[model samples]
Target: MSNDRVGFSQPQPEPDRQALGERLKEAREYMGLKQEDVAKVLGIPRSALSNIEAGVRKVDAIELARLAKLYQRPVAWFTGEDPEATSEVAKEVAHVARAAATLSQQDRQELARFANFLKSRAKAKATPDGR
Candidate 1:
């Protein structure tokens, strides 16, 4: 997803796979873990662990959750999918408001639509039962 969709004020593109991989690696390293340690915790091989960090292998949702637990971080921390992503997009909105002196009617309508969509998604994710 683009930064615009997520509320990035700068409105840049989303962080790419390499950036994600680096983030994952950094998180793991910060925990003082070896690749093999993580792999063992996930019951996967060390090579598979390397593959995941390299972004050659796509981690499933379960593995993502497991990784989050293993690293003692929220899943959003792992995916970079957080309120900050939305905040980044929001910053751009304020800039647009200031520069344009007013949001055009059409842009305001579009913003309303997108914001509603964002709200529903947040609701879905925030359900108590882990739906």
Candidate 2:
């Protein structure tokens, strides 16, 4: 008689934002720090860390750097800016862009108009001095 378990699950094709969130949470927990402890380590509030871990809030570069220092992890761990993530998102974006590039001149003009609108909206949300 023997007891064994083995099977290769199909790989997930998309970025798992939720699992990524949980992985960050688990890493924090493994460091033996509660949310408040992590907040204190980064000199922020518990609510901030809680919101971040819950994926309700986005993290900026500085905050990402602080988290990296506190967690004793490399900055790439938080930014997902490592080679792997960069290559993955880049490839997907390139795929979409190349397909769009085949559009006619008028279609490209309309797309540019929409992209400009989005850019303006993003700028409006920036700091007064303009980030």
Candidate 3:
């Protein structure tokens, strides 16, 4: 029964729990979700979520799935398996979101309207007659 015997399987390497925890924390913050809110949605105590973010506790598959859904990100991103997840565009989006968080409600609404206007203009340009 010794593992050293031939035909025995080697032990698998452990996942990087701390790095996963950091990604989870960053995603949660980017989504503007408080730990308590996420914990409640996951049917767990806030302390448990805190421990998970602190890398003191492991996240089960179900919790990870729920978190990915809530964060609107793929599980592969959290696991550091998505190579394009940290692209420049994503970083710029994050920066915009953080800056928008500091804006007044009226200014935020204006920003949203401007974004819609830009989208409309882009669509018009893509069309043949520029409607």
Highest TM-score: which candidate?
Answer: 3
What does candidate 3's lDDT look like per residue over 1-131, in tens digits? 68887757533324587788889999999978899999999999999898788776889999999999998888999999998989997899889888998899999999989989999999999999989
Q: Give the TM-score of candidate 1.
A: 0.50
Error in Å for residue 24 of model 1 = 1.5
Which regions of candidate 2 deviate over 4 angstroms? Answer: 1-20, 81-131
TM-score against native, each model? 0.50, 0.44, 0.69
Query: Measured by C-alpha RMSD in angstroms, how accurate is candidate 3?
Result: 7.5
Clashes of each: 7, 0, 0
Candidate 2: C-alpha RMSD after superposition:
17.1
Which pairs clash in the backbone of model 1? 7-88, 7-89, 7-90, 8-88, 8-89, 9-88, 9-92
* TM-score ranking, high to low: 3, 1, 2
lDDT score at residue 109, model 3, on the 0-100 scale: 99
Q: What is the TM-score (0 to 1) of candidate 3? A: 0.69
Worst 10 residues of 1 by lDDT: 6-15
In model 3, pairs of residues that clash are: none
- Candidate 1 lDDT over 1-131, as tens digits, reads 66555545432223465455676787687656799899988999998778677766678888888888887667785677775743766468546545443567788788778888988888889998645
lDDT score of model 3? 0.87
For model 2, residues 26-126, the per-residue Cα lDDT tens digits are 66765556887778877888887776776655666787777677765666755565656446765675465566667888997898799889888899778
Tell me, by lDDT, which candidate is best: 3
